[model samples]
Target: MRKMIHSKVVFSPEDLIVVAGISLQMAYKIIKELNHELEEINKKEKKNYIIFRAKIWRKFFRERYYDEKFLTINDLEKKFKIKEWEAKEIRSTIKKELVAKGFKFIKGRIPEKAVLEKIYDYSEEERKNENVSKIVKF
Candidate 1:
């Protein structure tokens, strides 16, 4: 199993309640629920999860734009017949959620997960190289 070092955080009950906007008991319950569901997550599911989330946004944009022609925000609003503010809110909400989930999203653009994977690969390679040089010198 791969291990990750994460900084420990200590939070008071009230502080956590305020941050999550839930009572301590409820927060604990939610965390318990999440923990149970998270047990199923692994590398295979993680890859599919990111892809699934991106595909959802892709579908949202496609459906929001009603016309078969070039679709703009105006077309989106007109097709959905929703207000401009509503359309804007939907887009913002989707982007915000993706970011919170560690998925980078650009307006009118979707970044490939390979970009983040490459960054991780490069950092790991650098660490390996450093370890090798240290061993050689010693």
Candidate 2:
């Protein structure tokens, strides 16, 4: 007997293709439908974004052809090479930042693009600080 393994992470089109034994085109169609449903839910909840910012676009493109759509806590831990507690803290911090910026977060999963963006931004900031400190020392 083959034991089935279920993933907690959000499914992308490729995942659908593998799990559902569907063609790429079919998987895309399913993704389109799911996206539409998600939009409707957002609308019903009155969660409208006045601005379609760069961050949102980044998130879209990053997740577009990827295998993981939404990342679970475990995925976050693996991606950042952090402990479970650190993952939770990072997720919470990101959530707070997004909320402050007027974005509504879907519960249970983190946006991969957002996580990547945060890491990139942090590294840039650190580099800038290091440059400033070097100049001061010189």
Candidate 3:
């Protein structure tokens, strides 16, 4: 069997409690919604089983929130063509920047809109060339 990178393929209620700072009751409700969505995927893929009432898929959770989207450190690393450590550092800087700008941010993830706008600045030229953005602090 292939080994997992993070030691977790699914998010348990306890994990949600810690990561999301939500109550256990809310966690269960989130899990239920995740399972329901999984059921839809099951139908499309013809999977035999899709019922996972106790957990939420981590990828799904990362791609979605309520109104805002996020980028995992891994995604940032790939998007910016940077190393993992650099991506992490940039994420930290960006997180602080966003919070100071009055936007809420979850720990260990970067807000997608802020990051893109910061790098691209609403210009295709910047998007084509990211080096001009000066992403590193020191």
Candidate 4:
């Protein structure tokens, strides 16, 4: 995958054909349906639109579908390249603090914000802090 999921990640019409292997007509129809649904979802934004915001068209299908937002200590250790004990400690610390911040989770699962904030630093503009992040599978 050339693209990684982000706050504003979306695909283009050409992406549908090349990546998804759908017909051009089907792509257009799908785009129409997606736009209609998105408009309904963001009704306020649809009403008074921001011209520079490129609201013309895009395929934002991840948030609605792919949801693997939590990870275990083992998962964190492997993904973040940290020691198992460190991962355990970090998860322990984050879990305690997150309870006050309205974050709920299972016994060994922690939110991916553990990946987002603690591991990979995200800026105010939704971009990564330094170079490329490990989220991209090379």
Number of clashing residue pairs in every model? 0, 0, 0, 0
Report model 2's TM-score to 2 decimal places. Answer: 0.41
Worst ten in a row by lDDT for model 1: 49-58
lDDT of 3 by residue, 49-98 (tens): 54666877766665444213457788888889989998888778777775
The C-alpha RMSD of each candidate to the native structure, in angstroms, is 16.8, 10.9, 11.9, 11.8
Q: For candidate 4, write residues 6-72 as lDDT tens digits.
A: 3234555555444334466755665665566566767855564222122223324333312235577
Error of 1 at 37 (Å): 28
Off by over 4 Å in 3: 1-7, 45-50, 66-138
Clashing pairs in 4: none
Question: Which candidate leads the pack in lDDT?
Answer: 3
Tell how far residue 3 is off in model 1, in angstroms: 46
- Say what the RMSD of model 1 is: 16.8
lDDT of each: 0.40, 0.57, 0.66, 0.54
Q: What would you estimate as the lDDT of candidate 1? A: 0.40
lDDT of 2 by residue, 53-102 (tens): 11122233233332234566888888789899988887788778767765
